[model samples]
Target chain A: MNSYPVTLKQSYSSALQAYLADAQEAALMRAYELGRQATENGLGVLDIAAVHQEALTQVLRPSSPSQETLQTVQAASKFLAECIAPFEMTHRGFREANAALKQQATQLANLNKELDAFAYSVSHDLRAPLRAIDGFSQALLEDYLDKLDAQGVDYLNRVRNASQAMGRLIDGLLKLSRLTRAEMRRQPVDLSATAQAIAEALRKSQPERRVAFSIAGGVTANGDPVLLQVVLENLLSNAWKFTSRHATATIEFGATWQDGKQVCFVRDDGAGFEMAYAGKLFGAFQRLHGRNDFEGTGIGLATVRRIIDQHGGRVWAEGAVDRGAAFYFTLEP
Target chain B: MNEKAILLVEDNPDDEALTLRALKRNKILNEIVVARDGAEALDYLFGTSVISGQDAPLNPEIVLLDLKLPKLDGHEVLKRIRADPRTKLLPVVILTSSTEDEDVVKAYGLGANSYVRKPVDFDQFSEAVRHLGLYWLVLNVPPRSKGR
Candidate 1:
């Protein structure tokens, strides 16, 4: 009887050791299935522990049973039961967590749909009144010009200006929301050529401004072309706007190797901000400069941050007052 | 002088007035039939509703369709217009304040001849109306109407 139990326990132990040694996920699953089968066939945890103790006792004493051996078996049984309890609890916890995660994902998807619909309606509805205000004001200026005084005309123009500014704000908000909702398509994009083109357009728009652009050759990235263009537009436009006061300005676009990864940068000799306010740079409507100083809706940098984030990239700026600013970004290789 | 009447399908009274002003300012003096809602627009086009009587202008030169309306939407109206043989080839321009990409793609997919986002500045809006009126009313040739 001692020999039979010893051989059976040795075979089971060896099988378990072989599977554990391989450490394959499938093998562990197989082991779990075997464990379940063994338990279901009238072999409880206590019985399994009793078998282990019997195997040890058989190995120690080849032919005879003793009171000392029985005591040892009881102690081993209690210890094995305690060891197995936590694993069962952990398995139950994992199942509950997975189910909860699935529920949350569904809720998130529904909320996104609701948000898209809300944005669409808001974009459509909000602009109508703005157009009316601007349009009617223009009408007053045009039709009632003979009867109205210069002050009246100025007031109407101010109303038109305010409404148009509001229109721009609404457009900016819509663009930001749309960026969040838009699907991204990734491909290798010629970022240098894109920057050069935008720079050329800026130059053409204001030929009197002597701004030199230095774009690195073959500087490319993997991202959605349209979104990347938006990024370049925002960054380059900022450079253009801030450098307007300078007699001559320089804007450079290039990439450098940092931490074994490629980091692209846009450097501009423009009106740089204080380091203390840098934290608020990428927030929507966060303007470091006064409206009188810089004409902006303050949505451009926020949009740039959002686009880069969507591309699984990072963006940061380094600047000092009147020294100029440089923006650096990185994408996954 | 252009004999074919133009259809201005807009919901908001303010927009309607502004759009009419824009057209007048641009010297687009073609007869314009105004529809306040998508349902009324469809009725005017298809002559299927109680309001579609002898006075309704059926064969419009161009349809300036707004996306958001009180009773049916622009998409539904465009779909009905495209589905019918009589109005299938009629030039329909999507004139709205929405610069959304989805709206543009959907409008084109639904067989819109053109899409123009209404500018907030009256001067720009007037210029856009002028170009639209000049192009659709005077320059572009229309397909023969069914003469219902």
Candidate 2:
């Protein structure tokens, strides 16, 4: 063996030496960093060698029997290999968790896209058959009204009415679907003005019906103005329809402070449903009354429920059969 | 009375017939030019395509545009109409079956003069059409025809 300079020899971790051995001579000094790290971790030769082969090989380079470098690098590498198992396990666990989360996110995104497509198809497909029914019924009435007797005319009328009701149902479904797809814009809405406008519209719709309205001033809520209008319109219209037989009908719009939050209410002296059906009140196409008693698509309350839910609110109804129905809805903070 | 004609751009034959019937029923007769789609509407207004057969000026009093059409939707048509300085101030009444909040907001934001939703009820639809036609034809004065 040739004699080496006193300061020329050094130890290395196996991994560091392995890397340096594959690299050029210029990379050996930089690769020695792993040996220092292994030493700092209190690793012995065999453990470091198994974990960091590159560093050990470089430092153990047998140029001219550098006995000092060979012994040091081998010891450090052997020591480091044992310490790496726990760290590697923890890293692998994290990698698996990350991969799982990514997969779940992709699945959720796909589900959302599928739901949107389904809504679109349902809305489009349902409208076509409804239109045909309405169109054909009207055509029959126009073409064969003279050939048919009173009974036939009545049958046609019923057919037309049923088709119209179906149309309303389709429209309601579409509205709900659109609401789901729509981007909501929240702003401060003047409840009093909104109520007044709805009241005015109701009055215009039935000029002969004398229905008095009371909207308390300074009542406001944060929501989409257009959607809130729909909410108010449905609630008020329901009140009006229910109270049609009443000699004197009164409708009130106001809000009350409940649990430190404003809970708005629409109260009317109208034909309200029994309390037993309250559970199904917000279900789509769930009507509490017979079609002959009061005409409705049964989706009004469902629409209201969806709107309230979107606004982060809750809706509930309180009333008896012939007394009055009051709907209370509150938006969350 | 402005000599400029009113352009009724509608695709459905039944809807077109009903609209014409309403206009006639209202008795506020102005020279009406009906185009079946957005393309035809543009052609009539620009004096291009089939409108070249007639010697009348291309300027229209108002454009009654439907949102949903077979070829070229209403929004794109509205954009094109607004982009041209010649038709920029033209009043476009968006008469459509869409009563969605987004549709209303978009039509108004696009500078539609009026946005009327088509009532599903036959009588109500007819009345709306009549009133709209009368208001645009007789009551509202058209922009000056000096440019054309």
- On TM-score, the leading prediction is 1
Please give, for residues A159-183, the per-residue lDDT of candidate 1 as tens digits: 9999988888888988888887878
Each model's lDDT comes to 0.84, 0.77
Model 1 C-alpha lDDT per residue in residues B1-148, reported as the tens digit of each score: 4476788899899999999998988888788889999988988887665545665447788999999888899988999999988789999999988878888999999999999999889899999999999999889988887554
On residues A259-303, what C-alpha lDDT tens digit does candidate 2 reach at each position? 898999999988988988888988999988887888888888888
Q: Candidate 2, what DockQ? A: 0.12
- TM-score (chain B) for model 2? 0.88
Write out fnat for all predictions, comma-separated. 0.93, 0.00
Off by over 4 Å in 1: A1-113, B48-57, B146-148
> Which residue pairs clash within candidate 1?
none
Candidate 2 lands at a TM-score of: 0.60
